[model samples]
Target: MNSHKQLFILSCLSLVLVLLSGQFGLQVEAGHHIHHRSKKLFVFGDSYVDTGNTNKSKPGSWKEPYGITSPGKPTGRFSDGRVLTDFIAKYLRLRTPITHRLWDYTVPKHSLKYGMNFAYGGTGVFDTSSSGPNMTAQIDIFNQLVQENVYTLSDITNSIAYVSVAGNDYNYYLATNGSLPGFPSFIASVVNQTTINLIHLQSLGFKRIVVGALQPLGCLPQATAQTSFQSCNSTFNDLVTLHNNLLNRSVTKLNQEINDHNTFTILDIFDGFRTVLNNPSSHNIKERLKPCCFGVSSEYNCGSVDENNVKKYLVCENPESTFFWDELHPTQAGWNAVYNELEKRGLYKILY
Candidate 1:
């Protein structure tokens, strides 16, 4: 067998072992003790969790075909439909957090009963390809809100914070042609900064903070398209593993220092994506690596239209059957499948 197949099998086996060993510390019980004390959610990070924070005119997320699977229109979400934050809100039994742009004028204060979403698509822990606020700046916005008393102490104490860094930092790293030798150090820096961000959120009075693990970069369509969607680039995934490992350690240490096992939690996007991709049939997914919407060639993308309004890309006949919606984001069905796995693994702990 080829190396890709071997790696795939080994990853599957490792997931099984990890699950059985309870290394993730997720409760497997069917029922959970509901925590009704917290009802609001505040979100941070990038496109994966962004509801609609990207600029309306500049970002591709605001263009056609982005939200075709659910709201049936562009809503500044880098997917074909609802992204991670939507599912997380549903899991929490709270209304979706309003985007920061719409929090004041378009929506009323009482409408913020579920809190706010400050994530911006195409952003990272630091500055990235997009011009939106970095993670630090995003937190600064939250901090500003707190100072203005937009949310009172009671509101914060009754809220949960969902922070998704995804892989924008690594994307920026690759885009800048960062050296492989320096990659490990960059990953460590991201974890350290993220740890500080989590601590800041805790200090801001959030009852619980959930940080997402970096997903498998090698499995994304942007990487797989180079191989005609046949196999993932293991070298890229190695970097992802390094990031997740360091992040897990950092979170453990942060929890220890805080003296609260439940103050900070990790949303295992790495294993979650891996399990879904490795077992696509079980998740009712076909075309596992192929994206549902893409440019006909290298110069365009899913919703691209020429000056004459000529379509430049093609969309799949059935987006629901595909795992990816575009070069970098998942289809609605894909997120749902992954969310199901997350729910089964231990999302209940965060919800309840």
Candidate 2:
């Protein structure tokens, strides 16, 4: 991550950080079979999959209580522990890919074991007030790396692509006061651009791509805060349903057009969230929509402070017992439960 005050600023970046691993090389005995293809993984999207791709100087993700669960300090991940990227890589028997912006001094010159992560926090398919690189820009950076031969074409063909397009685009829309009546058309445009991005990846030689469906935005702590964390705003979720439906149709059409049934797929995070929210006890989550960490007042957020450096936001006793870590992201445990739920539903398979 760059040190120059860390760019990638989003509108209400802290309030809505929108999101929305394993060891290297040694094969595990627990795995059944992964010998057929390359184990490389490439992740792209917003804070959901971003593993420190944003600037280190940014306060929201770089602040304390963000990574308190796993690393005990902020490592640029939005959650208190790991995010979706780490778990997905673990399932593939691959190490968590290095962040595209991370340039560790102790790094070896032999090259990255996993492909590379290009997701940035608070970003989306199109540019928002957040002012970070959009999805197309991230892809452009990946293309640049490929042109530099940092990774071979074989790596591109063999790699699995994981994409998370949370709700930042819609957040941007609402933030910018986009009309309610025309909002549906805006969602269609977002899905269209996302499909274009997927097609662009296919052109780059990726065989398998898994994109997350839009999670229920109404259920996020941000909207539920209006109801004192007791219930979700169904109106917001209705729009999310529209987006997911269009995305699914577009992916299916893309697969049909290419005559490859498995080339593109949806990760079905929408259902995963619903599974946990609808039955919190099953996931051991005590609070479904209320975030574990939040501001003492409306003015503060998960990691806020006063002029004397006193903390403003309050953190829960145990983030694991709760579902949301913040207004727009899930706790490490929340993400883990969602991952487990997705597995249970058998929405699709990766690296198979």
Give the alpha-carbon lDDT of every model. Answer: 0.87, 0.85
lDDT (Cα) of model 1: 0.87
Error of 2 at 223 (Å): 0.6
Choose the strongest candidate by lDDT: 1
lDDT of candidate 2 over 1-352, digit per residue (tens) = 6644354443445324232213333332333443323568898899999988778777678899899999999989999999999988877767898988763343564447677899999999999766569999988998888898877888888788888899898999988999999999999999999999999999998898889999999999999989999999999999999999999899989989989889998898999999999998998989888899999998999888889999999999989999999999999999999989987776335445
lDDT (Cα, 0-100) at 268 in candidate 2:
88
Question: In angstroms, how far off is 277's CA in candidate 2?
Answer: 0.8
Give the per-residue Cα lDDT of candidate 2 at 301: 92
Q: Count of backbone clashes for each model?
A: 0, 3
TM-score of each: 0.89, 0.89
As for candidate 1, its clashing pairs are none
